[model samples]
Target chain A: MKATGAYEPIFAGERRKRLDDVFTCYPTKRAALLPALWIVQQTHGWISDEAMTEVGQVLGVTAAYVKGVVTFYTMYHQHPVGRHFIQVCTTTPCNLCGAEGVVEAILEHTGCGDLGATSADGRFTVIEVECLGACGFPTAVMVDDDFIEGVTVDGVPELLGRYP
Target chain B: MGYPHEPHPKETLILSKHFGDAGARSYDGWVKCGGYQALKRALAMDPADVIEIVKESGLRGRGGAGFPTGLKWSFMPKERRKPHYLCCNADESEPGTFKDREIMRWTPHALIEGCAIAQHAIQAEVCYIYIRGEFTEPIAIMQAALDEAYREGVLGGNAMGTNRRIDMYIHRGAGAYICGEETALMNSIEGRRGNPRIRPPFPAQQGVFGMPTTINNVETLVSVLPVLNEGAEWYKDLSLGNPKSTGTKLFSVCGHVRKPGNYEVTMGFPLGELVNDLCGGMRDGRTLKACIPGGSSVPILNREETEACLLDYEGCVEQGTMLGSGGVIVFDDSADMVYQIMRLARFYAHESCAQCTQCREGTAWTVRILERILRGEGEMKDLDLLLDLSEQMTGKTICVLSDSCAAPIVSGIKKFRDEFEAYITGAKQPVAALT
Candidate 1:
């Protein structure tokens, strides 16, 4: 079957070699699927259908199977997200510590206007996430790869400045 | 030790002694602090002996289940037919739990050393520390520590110069709360969707590529090093005379507390004292109204239960909850019980894997019901309907995700019915906007 879109392959050259090396850790070739998908997300910021097909091809699984795994996880963006995707923990623990106000402050400061919507500048995308596993440090936020803890509504502006 | 703060005089620091010290993050610094001594000692002793010593220490899993750590280890096959796997469960996504994160962030070497000892005890050549991807810093810190361990011959073909071959790797998980479950964790490591598998041929018999596998919580394994080093009796005596719940457990205190952080205290410590004295009670003039002593999955505790509660396994059980993961979430009188309960419901509804029909339907419906109650649209009939839905949701799924959704709802209704009734009766204002 011909490829669906103009998707540049992620697992090629050195990246392909890295993916191949990951296979050594697991007994089955299929076991490297999560790492393979992560490599795609890290490189492309989202997993397009064509990229899912490509990952399926590499892992000897169907495109539907790859998409199935991709959609199951919250971190993997199916569509293109902002350059900096910020997930704020607003669960019960964080909520008790005024996480909602922090979310509101982030949505306002990031110019995203709403949760999950990218700002007009395409600089930020903010969303309320479940627990980020740092409950003791309430109102934890993750701006891309950075896991920041003890974030407050008052500090959202200063924090966003550091991000951009 | 209450991390990010001074250790309380009452705290018994076993696994969290080097929490705030940045030097303890590296292998050399850890070595200077007498770090790998437990692993060195374990390498000399028989793996069976190591397992026996841990079993006698009365150490239990800290990942919410409270399963006996040593008992879980002994379940692995005595005669290893296939490659046995040891998975260190570092996927700490529980809403109120953060102790494991501290262990990984600060004492990376201690965890690696613990994994090394565990790998030896379980007769597994390979150990995979499955960490959640959200923990970028902990992952980087642990990866550096693992790299240092390999360079220093602590984890490799000939780990610590021992003839036994042990290889430890990090399998990063994409965001999935269900992946914290042991079976789901194995499925995730296998590059599949993180779905919980049914038990019958449990992980001990067939797990992770259909081999004998032993999965343990981060706190559970790290505590093993101390058990082997200090002898089982000393470790057992660390608890306040609780034979069932030995050793000092790290309780992550958050929410309305004046001082919130990971507090390490001996078993049988009073929950009231930990909240009032150690955590400095509620903020300002607020009084304690509610608490979830364990992770968010457990039942909520009322003020009376909160004050009289013990911090041990049996003590929590007596109060109609479990000392699960030791993540104490405090709530002051200002907290809205009905709305907060709805938020908890929403978390489970969002996290459900949807494999089990009950969890998929029950969690979503529970959230809807709770949201309806929070929106002042609920009637008294809806309360019983919520109870009925919760009853059906419990113990009817492949995993406890559905049961977890039901726990807070059922407990909240039983203990704090007045709050739910007020929402239904329109006495309490609708706080949450319609979704």
Candidate 2:
């Protein structure tokens, strides 16, 4: 987990205006925490301590409070990840339908080698996630913003090929 | 967007009637298909009358618990002395349930219209649809639909020129399963960690922003459309037999099934037919070993119990399970019951909020014990120890996440003791170390 240096302000100019617009939607400015965190992640690959402080300052909360909220959620990465983040659903429903084999294939092909590890080439970071809520489509893999369903061992290479 | 299979003859299809139709996602398409008629008519009637019609229809909550939907609405302050809020639980993170995802994807307008009507019924000016963050597709679709609705004057300060303020917004969750609980959802919206709050000050009393709030599941809110459109009697008559459990329910079939999708059938429908006929029955020749009739949170049923189970609130209780989200996970003869049980335990262990000692420790300890047993290092006493731990886990937490972990472990050991015994006795080979 390498830290990308030179932390810059996230809530600036257009982004600050966007956050301002969302403030009217909620009765409290603090309620925009989740959406603000989402905006930070959408801009930067991961959230750092410095970003947390900036977000806290904007939302009128503390950096420690922002950190507490970020760590509680699995989606908010604290450090930089590979260019493409892969979350494979290995919950019971997916596991019952050959999700393990698919995980094996993804690791082997993506070269992530193990769960929660980034590939040596810095292209992929694969992790096993619990229930993507698409149990009907077993082994649902969310690569970055894409929700790829019905993936199989044979389709691993073709699936990742699109990302590269 | 079309589902692979056609609607089975047994499916009644009211809420799912417009599924797979791309046009139904738009505001215009929804209006053309008689969608907003309920909201229009509901605006003309007294809000109490709207709640009464829903109460008369007997439509219960679909997001587990099966509580009466209209009764839940009536809990809100009727005089509107303070600001009232409505929460739409679109965080469909329950393991086996995904019908709400389809609703937002194919029929976004239905959810918005339902929320608008619910806002009127509960006398709330603002509504928030709390959708899980993982649902990027549904969120975008729903956001687009909402923009269309606002542009068309269907929802705003003066909704449809009715002079009633109905402001609906979507609040995205940040990957916490416990937030699906009503109180936790409120806290999450307040920019705090998704920890479930203690009850008895309930949501209707103090909710998001510490005001009177009425929260309902995405499916439960959408079901109100049929009750208002076709009248309460028509929806009440759709049930198979039980008057207590009325109207159609969407069952999400997954696991070792041939044709897996959301099957909308009336209440009191036989589970056997849902599995055998509608789901195309265990592949070609594979016989059913077990089934989790509800979501993974509910107890598992053995083959005989599954075959005899009925798909209703009362019928499911008789067979020793609750109709929780109606996410049926089928297991074929080839499934390893011991390993599958371990996976469910791991899911809860990872999702525990750590606020409650029972859930935080109980879920992790249960996973460890199950892993040890799977690793071929268990005694016969381990089974009893697990049961003891499960008892401690149940009813001892702020939320049911730990109890959810205990359900499958307890039920799995009771129904499939032979499988557990086989692993202990070394009759079954130890599985390879999983990462």
Candidate 3:
């Protein structure tokens, strides 16, 4: 089973070491699915079906077991996205601050809404999400991984324009 | 221009009356301000009386569940052989909810004092604060306050010279949202994976090493301190709305609004006034599109319905949604229902504890279908499937997380089916998802 992706070599050895540490942390190997998926996603940008199967094998569980976890949570992405994954907070707190407009602005600029879809030019993929714990800064969106607070419809183009 | 800042509609609750410097987690500072007097008053009364007082005050759990605080405390098995436990759920992970963190950050003593009162009432010898791992700074603040309590002979064994003994400790979770669920929080405190357990043996009966446990949210517990001090009558009068729902609630308003911060407002206040007047109206003069009155878990409210909705628990329920954690997210005209549903689905998909098969698979299915639709690759049947899957997922899990995830998808489709249909026809892309 060609479980390893092309990007695996970048952190293959380190991933293996982290996998071992994860096993030691938990009494049961099956419990390590989340942390292991995090490590793989950090290394590969997203979790592929192949990566899930590989993680299941290393943890002595079934591919279905890992897939159940990977798919259940929003943090893990299955397909590749843009170099920068922009997740705007569309939940109630952020929505009150024009989170929807900020999302619209990003989508208009990027042309992709799902987590894995990239823009035609491969610049960005805008994913609208619930609250990001920064409700104080409403209409907040996380660019790549850093939170960009107080984003508005007009401010979105200026923000993304700088990324490329 | 930057978003406008609205002054708090009411005075701060636990953060009120800081006599000295802003940073006062020390025992001496809290004592000078009459901190543990409530604990003294609580200990002097019959434990049953304390419970009765809270029950009479109509204080609901500030935790997302909104269960009756007094009723929850009274659930302890009186004849249970093992010692009862009070687990303070400081694991505040809900997306728009941050009131607990602010309480812990500003008035850690309020939580510590609240824990002492709960321990006395429940007759529990030990209490543990289960905080989220990401709250590194707030955890330190809690620890310092706890340590000061210990130094002053207030926390460990024979707290405040009462015959009863209560000890408090801090346990940090490894960042799982499910841990916010009471049973899952108990499991994590016991050093297990943060997966939720089934109710009916609800934490009140068997919890934390097979002993009786009562889990209370940080804000809920802190509210008790003042309720005990000023008496239940004062708390009941603090409400600006229905008598059943008393006291002030910290409404965390965000999105599209000019001022988006935590505003403590009386229950039953008009939603329109709070949004347009309090939040300084929608930014850039955009038209209001929709809103999620509570946290993301509750159903979304369209512009017409939300305009009439009030910022209280009953008001929201009357409008076919809930005041879940009081996280109000607003949206403007540029907002797209299709993209909004997809984003919310992704959050539920990511946070499912995976204990129950239905919630485990159902959340993922919701996200996958939403992902396909947002990609402009949706079929008409997919919308029906999204609704069907959401129905299957609700109330069929160990925790409410499943229902929380499914509610938005069901509501999103019900309220915005046209948006989904429009996407299929390739007529107009939602402004929010227009890339």
lDDT of each: 0.91, 0.91, 0.75
Residue pairs of candidate 1 with colliding backbone atoms: none
Interface DockQ of candidate 1? 0.88
In model 1, the runs with Cα more than 4 Å from the true position are A1-6
Whole-model lDDT, model 1: 0.91
Question: How much DockQ does model 3 earn?
Answer: 0.20
| Chain A TM-score of candidate 2 vs. true chain A | 0.95
What's the number of clashes in each of the models? 0, 0, 25
Taking all chains together, each candidate's TM-score versus the true structure is 0.98, 0.98, 0.76
Model 2 pairs whose backbones collide: none
C-alpha positional error of residue A70 in candidate 2 after TM-score superposition, expressed in Å: 0.3
Alpha carbon deviation, residue B51, candidate 3 (Å): 0.8
Worst 10 residues of 1 chain A by lDDT: A1-10
True contacts kept of 2: 0.88
Error of 2 at A45 (Å): 1.0
For model 2, the stretches where C-alpha displacement exceeds 4 angstroms are: A1-6
Q: Between 2 and 3, whose TM-score is larger?
A: 2
Best by DockQ: 2
TM-score of chain B of each: 0.99, 0.99, 0.93
